[model samples]
Target: MPDFDFTALRRFPDVEADNLFAYDASDHLILDEAADDLHAAAPGEVVVIGDRYGALTLGALALHDAADIRTHQDSYTGELALQNNAAATGVTGFRSLDLGEELLTGSRVVLMQMPKSLSELDEVAETIARFADPSVTVFAGGRLKHMSIAMNEVLGRHFGDVRASLGRQKSRVIRARDPRPSAESAWPQRAYLDELGLWVVAHGAAFAGPKLDLGTRELLRHLDEMNPDARTAVDLGCGTGLLATALARTRPELAVLATDTSAAAVASTRATAEANEVAITVRRDDGLSQQPDACADLVLLNPPFHTGSTVHAGVALRLFEEAARVLKPGGELWTVYNSHLTYRPALYRIVGGTRQVSRTPKFTVTVSTAR
Candidate 1:
């Protein structure tokens, strides 16, 4: 049995905005060359990055009887696809990582699909360089439209020596031999929009790193009014650690757990935690991964409405339900969302109560809980 399938993805027209299902097809749009070849080579330990679905991951795992598979993905849907596909194929030896912590390196082979950000690529390069060595090989693959001659050069900078495979399915795989660790440079820094006349530092892979996002802005306004004495809190989708840092600053006594699914977001949040000199726990987590049931006093979120080019509410809905599961009785779950999302009814259904905290012309903030 194939470890994954994508028949369900056909119902949605847009790939970025809808509930995404794992697919066997490669559109050859965001391609990486190394990954194309690895479908055929079954090394025992395979690490995959930017696996949009469980496609490359489970395929590699199913190729061997006792295989080790690791994947780093940023979006909630991407992680969900990995699990759904893994369960479908019964391929179990897989590790799913978000944007930060350290990238798992030193695999017999590493597979990467091209991401949308250059800084992300650099971050992946730096993180993986820490864990790879001469014995490890990194295989990269991308669609011809997505790869350039410089693609191999970028791969060459870290892994040393690059060879390209003949194109198949309009996808070519690049073989990156000799995993020589690259020098640690200053982490990539970019600015993202925040409030008017204000922007924040975002490393690669944050949502709108050069500025504060619209949903996040809606989220930012609600933080100042939350109970200052709530002793335990969580920023469920703690992107770039901005909301978590602000929460820590405002509620000095509140123990806050910050998390995001993006490897880049995790790294940036870690840096943000260090820069603010606050003691917030930061991790690359799936939605509420490390959280315990009925424990959080407050869960703050600006749930994402889209994943990359796709727009949908699957992730936000998932987060809302997750918040419900993790909140203590009488604990509040707060979020800022697009007005068009009509998240209030769903909010009501999950937590049994919902109230609009505030709103902009384009967005609304709501507080819900099992009071």
Candidate 2:
């Protein structure tokens, strides 16, 4: 094993702040717990999922001499960060892949950063069980505060044996083996939101997962009033493409684009749009970075308040700035967020003149016009 410096990793291209981090105790603990399996596995037998940056992938490559490592990172930002970190560390051999057979097939050892969502965990576990070698061992780690008994139960559904390791630095790893592959994958779930008259489709990692979140529901109420003459609209951070599909369905002439950082979210949005027979251009993007400046007449956002498990407003603020950058002068940016965030002042400063569209006890919807 080589001496690997986890602290040297950086979350570049992702939101970086004094408090936000590229790696965590969980990453080290997972690597440590799975060290034997990782080292003993044959070339191309190790697969990493949910690597926030390149911590697990790079650590496995550098420390275990793991070869032909295949990894899946849901966030596009995480993928870019991994690329940047690998280049900086001069670590090679790992390939970023989507969550499917190609990434998991013949995988004897799997290292994962446990997702916060149970559905996401289930999806990953099912995929591993279905595709990985029968003798595969999974090391799924997360901060103790985020780990729940439900996660064990979720993994147990796909793996016959599951056990937990002792906590280290407030992180713990769950080891699972004896694959119990299911006949079908329960992912890419769908539900009809009768109230909204829309069919929501979601992959496990998609936010709110095939359901209309309260914040989005509030914003949906005002979609008809958003830039009435707008010809081009963007559903920034479109989860399940509810807003994008709704906008397209209501205004067929509008050119709708849905952009999200999460691959699952982008896929879900595309599926949602297709299911509704609405034409929405879906892109896996870091906010509206790929869109040209002043190109959008309206941008709808239900900005997430959290960056991973941390309750940070930085992610939402960054999206606000992106929405502002992509909006034409006088274009409207309709945003829905938790009321406690009080993003009005920030929106006014970052986007333009802002006004409350609607407010509830828990959520607030506001529209900001580009200055």
Candidate 3:
């Protein structure tokens, strides 16, 4: 294997900060553990899933001369970052694909960055078992702090043998072999939310998965109160498309759009809209960047406070800025957030004058009219 420098990678087109990173110890650990298999595997036999940037894909190509690599990244931001980093490093030989048979259908070795959600892991594991060759070996890695015994159990369900590696650099890898294919897929789960009178659909990685989160529930309570004259609305960071579907169902006259950064979220939202039989435009976007400035009359947001496993306010603030950009004068931005975030001042400064619509002990709902 050739020496490859992982530090050359960057998280372009994604939020970058001193604390956030594109590559981590887990990426290196996964690659190192799968080194022999990656070198011996034939072209197109190696698949990478949950590659945050291009570390796994590019590292394989750079170090092992791996070719025709198929990769799947759930986050559009991560996908773009991988592309950008590949271009920057001039490391190429991989194709970004959606999570399915196309990405998993193969033989031999698989490198994966274990997701925080067990459901997501289950979906990926089941897909691998169902599609990949029975002889395939999967090396799934993550930071030790984020990993748990349950992850081994998740992998154990689909693999006859699942074992863990000794921790290295605060990271660990779980190796699984002897595929036990299942006939069923456990993803894109669905449930009916009685409170909203809507069916919520969610993929494994979708936030809050097929359930009405308390924050979104709080925001939905004011749906009828938002700008009665509004004709156009956007559900910024739409997870399961609850807000957009609800809006379209209640006011068929209103043109509603649902946008999210995660591929899973977009898929879930579209499924939710289809299940609810509501007309909604669902797009996988970075906030409302694709929307025209001053185009929306009202925007609903339940912005996330964390980026990945790291708790940070930058993600929410960026979404607020996007909401401000897409909202027209006199437009309203309704946001539901944890009370501890204290986003009122920032909302007032970024969007316009903000007013508290309702507040629970743990959550706060506010409406800011665009300036």
lDDT computed for candidate 1: 0.67
lDDT of 3: 0.91
How many steric overlaps does candidate 2 have? Answer: 0
lDDT of 2 by residue, 121-164 (tens): 98889999999999999999999999999999999999999999
- TM-scores, all candidates, are 0.71, 0.98, 0.97
Choose the strongest candidate by TM-score.
Answer: 2
After best superposition, candidate 2 residue 314: deviation in angstroms? 0.6
Tens digits of per-residue lDDT for model 3 on 200-270?
Answer: 99999988988888998898788899998899999988988888998899888899999998999999999
Better of 1 and 3 by TM-score: 3
Clashing pairs in 2: none
**Candidate 2, superposed: residue stretches over 4 Å from native:** none
| CA lDDT of each prediction against the hidden true structure | 0.67, 0.92, 0.91
TM-score of 2: 0.98
